[model samples]
Target: MQAQQFEKLSLLVDDQLDKPQSVQLLKSVRHDPALQAKLQRYALISQALKGEQAAVADLDFADKVKQQLKSEPVYLMQRKKSDDQFKKTSLAVAASLLLAVVGFYAGKMHNQVQTLAQATTTAAAEQSPAEQMNAQFKEYLQAHDNVWYVNNNAGVKSYARLASYQSR
Candidate 1:
């Protein structure tokens, strides 16, 4: 009754259905006049198609079609070349941008280093040799204090005692 049953009838006429399915379909067709008529139509169509052939007079039809295809303009090929060139140009631009960023950072770091060096030289020139030595010893003691707290060892305790004596 459904469209699928009609399709099954067509397949049955073509002998394409399995034996059990074919026998079942034949039993249904025997009882149903409409199914028999549909099956007859499918068989006629199959016979007509089997008798049909290409109307071309010459055997060179395939060669002619091949020649026509060869002569046709392939726009996809041109577009692909353009796309490749665009990708290359984009890659070059990206590389240039990356290099510029790296160069800028490198230049900034160099300037910072130079500024620190100038500051150190100016500070050294303003202080006496004894004052500079005292300042250096104080800085060393401060750093040693941090290490003493972290280590909490007997050697660190002795070093801390000596540092306190020197600071006093």
Candidate 2:
């Protein structure tokens, strides 16, 4: 699935299989001439590339590898210290960016809350009961501006007139 995985599989194919297992695999496919030809072609290619086929013919590869290991040992040293340092730096940078985003949103939310509080206080100050009643009365008077009051000798009476009254 990954280049690393493919490389590991290739290493297994080239280096890990026992000679008997390799022979068994080759023999299993020997009936298929095309498969045998392909194996021979790859063997030749490997021989040509490595210049070690003659040595392979004389020696058991797995035993030779084990003998070489007994003679000259190998150890893997840890080298991820610098890589780990870089990872920590990357994590710190990401954390700073995340904090900046949160701070920006918090600042924006704080400003919005302040503005809302100011607006509510302003609205409350402007909405006294007396002021509301006066506004309603003024609206009613303006809507009925064409009406008139008449006082007759018999009784107080009301009349309608087309004259309009305006208020500021």
Candidate 3:
């Protein structure tokens, strides 16, 4: 048979031919024994391909997968109780150590400030009024000299620091 005749037979087997085209192909097929044999061959090939798909689907693939999953060991993911307890204990100990260090520094500073205040009071009592005023003025001048660097700096923050110490 010619290639065009084989192609028309394939299109007919696939249901791709329109009604008029199918009628024309059928008319040609009626007169040709070779075309009838070709149609039977195409139908056999199509049925074989479809049968393979149906055969595979009928083999119970889903049921086999379920059986495999049921045979596997179940696993649990979680930390042990002892590890959680240890983490909480370590965190508490670290917080207590931090508080203790902070308390020690605060108490030490408080004691030093009290001692300095007592020393200043005792020194002021020993000096006469005129000597005390002169001593106070000298201390004030020394304090001002300590922050003299602020006078040359330029910024709102620098002026703020200077203003806080200006009167005292």
Ranking by lDDT: 3, 1, 2
After superposition on all CA atoms, how large is the RMSD of candidate 1? 16.0
> lDDT tens string, model 3, 55-152?
22323466789999999999898956898788999999999999999999999999999999999999879889999887677678668873444343
lDDT of 2: 0.64
The TM-scores of all predictions, comma-separated, are 0.36, 0.33, 0.34
- TM-score top scorer: 1
Model 1 regions lying over 4 Å from their true place: 1-80, 146-168
**How many clashing pairs does model 3 include?**
0
Model 3 earns a TM-score of: 0.34
Clash count, one per candidate: 0, 0, 0
Question: Residue 160's C-alpha lDDT in candidate 1?
Answer: 37
Expressed as tens digits, the lDDT of each residue in 2-116 for candidate 1 is: 6988989878767788999998888998888778677767777777788953332343466799999999997754433678888999999999999999999999999999999
Error (Å) of candidate 2 at residue 102 is 2.0
Candidate order (TM-score): 1, 3, 2
Tens digits of per-residue lDDT for model 2, 53-164:
5332322466788888899866788765688889999999999999999999999999999999999889867898998786677667668762232112334343434456
Candidate 3 at residue 28, lDDT?
91
